[model samples]
Target: MTIKPHALKKGDQIALVSPASRPHSAEALARAEAVVEKMGFKPIIAKHALSINGYLAGTDEERAQDIMDAFSSDSISGIFCLEGGFGSIKTLSHLDFSQIKKHPKIIMGSHENTCLLTAISNQASMVVFHGPNICSVDRVESIAEIKSTLASSTILPPVTPSLGSFPAGFHHTSYPGNAQGTLIGGNLNAIASLMGTKYSAHFNNKIIFFCERDERNDIIERWFTSFYLAGHLKRIAGIAFGEFPDCGPKDSLSMKSYQDILTERMIEHKIPSTFNMPIGDSSLSRVMPIGIKAKLDATNGKLEFTESALD
Candidate 1:
């Protein structure tokens, strides 16, 4: 059964923990705290929220302990990652899935947090969010929408086509069909890294959405094909490709676009898929719910949630 966490209310305490990398500076943390306060929520910084050990927010054990403490604390109504970098995977083994299952509070983040979100959904059976972290939270233009998503349990309406030119290499493929399944996926690199591990996502009969950044075409192709070869792509109801900033081909000789490669793979699997979604590393990025029942209409380029991600 899917566990829906209680919706946020005004003055609810949100624990800000750094499960991945540390913020760029102390100012970044202060800015995030200000933004949270402006949104009418209390921001409680975790013990390791500002600590830095190389590129990570802190040691693996320290980061994991912050997450554990956040979930176990009765005062915290939600948990949000400080930033997404390179250490979340290291903290997985130290996490207490049972504590998360028992608390059942909203946990939200993206990028490196993808690993944690997927694991929590699978292991704790809780609804988690895939969206901007503390750094991106204040940068997002739709702060009100984000607040609503955290506070409301109402089913989302159909997503309208975004008004903007598609990114270079994006294709508006016309696959006329619709499919419904639980939403699962995040950063392509992070998701692929979890392959064969206990935290790897079970894409069977699910709507898988992924995006990448700063990766060469060759590397992207290998990862995309890895999913196909592993039989994960074949069983998915549909696929949604998100913004891939700076993910162009490294060599000019390669004529195949990233979209072309992805399209080919989707065709081979005979799965309905759409590209150029405004999720991931886009300025117009919208918040998406992980582990919620959603409908993907590839024909019209729309994704609708059949149920709310939170209670």
Candidate 2:
């Protein structure tokens, strides 16, 4: 399916809706607004972006309406999820997929937002981004990725490598080979959530899967087991793992334990894998296009931009 690019213009209105976590203070919202305003686009908040109901931003019905309203509004050019925590999957069936498909717009977020972005793209055939959220990390690289993706006249190379230059806090590796395919993946838990669902992204020939999860101790083992058992990881040409945002220092297991779990899981499938490719809760994050074709070099441990993320 060909996706129409929803590129941003000078005065484009970007709707900020909370499809997930809603436990936000007034100060946090102000900061988010400031971040959006700094980018020069009008950031309009959904009425329930700050509503909190336990762990959810709002009721599934209310969140779904906010998303549907954004896409249905003629004045809005894009939908930017305010933040991701959980609950995106709960609101799925309530969304108007047909209306969103007819008036396609850029939908962007990461973490748990992965569920919504991937599901909508696969079901509606729209190009939703796996980039940073408004209240999420908006580093220089992340902003640049967003700008390039939403701009016209941008051309991506046929094959790209993950940018080299590891800082002291991070580690890297080399895959030594490359494969090309439509990029499809997000949070590991999110991908796992799509099992038995019609909205799951179809893994076809030569697809490169990028995934990450919150770094919870011993959880990686179960997550990867369920993910592979779901047949989501077996068909991909390559894999890239972003920072596990849920990893906490309180956990008894060391960082190496988490890495070992990932390695073991990939080795179980005998597929080449790359880890520590950056995207996470850190202030520094790179925004990767969700559905665009790109090269994953496990030898050099890099994911390069190959084509423009949008049509």
Candidate 3:
């Protein structure tokens, strides 16, 4: 069964945990805290949120423990990852999925936290947020919509022209068809890393939305081919491509663009897909709920949620 967390309130206390990388500095954390407070929610820093172990926030066990503690805590209404770099996968085995399943709460982040989000979706069957991290809290221009999404249990509609500012690809559609399924997916690199693991997403009969950044077209092609070889692309109800900023071909001699590579793959499998979705490593991204049922209307360029992500 799908487990939805309770809707957040103005006074809800959110725990700031670093499941992936540590904050850039103490100043960044303070700014993040200030932004959360300005949003009218209490920010509770996780015990080891700032511990740095090379690039990671802390030891794998310590990072995992923060998540466990947050979910098990009576005071914390939600858990927000401080930032996403790498290391979340190391904590996967240490996490108690059962404990999180028993006490579902909003767990939100993007990029490297894609592993955690997918794991929670598959193991806990809980609706989780895929959006800005604590690092992006202060940088985003307007967070009113973000606050609204977190504070209520409401179905979200597809991206409209006015909803976001995307590049030219946002208007592109691969196939003219409509399909509905529970939303599943996140960063392309992170999602691909989950292959051959227990935490890998079950894309069968689901609307998969994926994004990437700082990768070359060749690497993107390889990852897409991996999904196809794994039989994930053949079984999905539909596909939605998100922003792939700074992902151009490393070799100038390569003729195909990143969009061409993605489109050819989807067409090869005849999957109903849309490109240029606003969710990804961009400041203009909006919150997208994983594990929630949504309709992918490729014919009309829309992805409308059929249910609320929270109770």
Candidate 4:
């Protein structure tokens, strides 16, 4: 039951929600709504999208209610998270996966929202989006792809090894080969948090992709080990390591960098993996459809979206 959301048509209403944290401010929220309108869809802000409660946009109950309300609403063709922060994990318990499954539609967000994306896709059996939150809809980092992904029913363009779509950085191929599987990934820490839980997306026979920011290589090494120990990555076909900004060694350049850790781990696991494939926090990052099948050609350095996210 891999449910595909219908491609959004112009004039469709896109619900704006704060499943994590509210946008930077009311003004930022306004701008994000404007971005939605500019993309040719009406924006319907959730009731609690602007409610501030400690670090979260609103209480877990409020956030969960807003998400479910939009999913259950026939008028809302898609739902976009306002910002990425710490609340999606908290709101999960309150969510009714049955509601999402019954009314399957697009739910797009990135960063900490990974918790929700992975959960809904796995537990609810529907496609979810891995892309910039609404706050970044117009940012140079993710605008083009966001617009393209929302309306297209065709396959997303392949990310080539030339690294042309990516920003200037350390892009490399860990193992040279090809693999095709359901696209499964998100923020490394967020996805890893659900390792032993029912919410976790099983990695067996999947083309895994994950990313992080402002994290050290050592901690990343530990996360990888944890996944391996949990037997999550033992049979992964391949991996796409997204941008790791400020993840290198500041204490010493000689220390094994982020690149070193990923290179070593991929080689050790014997997985056909590659780094820097425009996953997140990267300028012009690709808007990937999670829970959809995809092909990873590490040798050719081109990751292909084998299926469209939308019907």
- The best candidate in terms of TM-score: 3
List model 1 lDDT by residue over 14-54, tens digit each. Answer: 99999999989999999888878777899999999999899
Candidate 4 local distance difference test against the native: 0.84
Candidate 3 lDDT over residue span 157-215, tens digit each: 56532354634334578876888898998999899999999999998899988888888
Candidate 3 clashing pairs, residues 3+ apart or interchain: none
Candidate 2 Cα lDDT to native: 0.71
List where candidate 4 sits over 4 angstroms from the true fold: 161-170, 250-254
lDDT digits (tens) for residues 1-311 of candidate 4: 69999888889999999998888888999999888887889999999999999999889999999999999999999999889988899998999998899998989998899999999999899999988888866564365567778789888788653345435444578887889998899899898888888898888999988888877777877787788887766689889988677876655544887778778778878889888777775555787899888899887567898878898
Candidate 1 TM-score over all chains jointly: 0.94
Q: TM per model?
A: 0.94, 0.87, 0.95, 0.94
What is the per-residue lDDT of model 2 for residues 1-311, given as tens digits with 9 covering 90 to 100? 74755678766888989999863677777777767666667888898999888899889999999999999999998888778888999999998888888988888888788889888887787767777777864465556556655754354442223344245434344233566677777777787777778877676644544556545656656766776777755776777777675564346554556667667766666555666766543445555566776777776665666666654
Error of 1 at 240 (Å): 1.1
The per-candidate count of clashes, in order, stands at 0, 16, 0, 1
Question: Between candidates 2 and 3, which one is better according to lDDT?
Answer: 3
Candidate lDDT scores, in order, read: 0.83, 0.71, 0.85, 0.84
What TM-score does structure 4 among the candidates reach?
Answer: 0.94
- Rank the candidate models, highest TM-score first: 3, 1, 4, 2
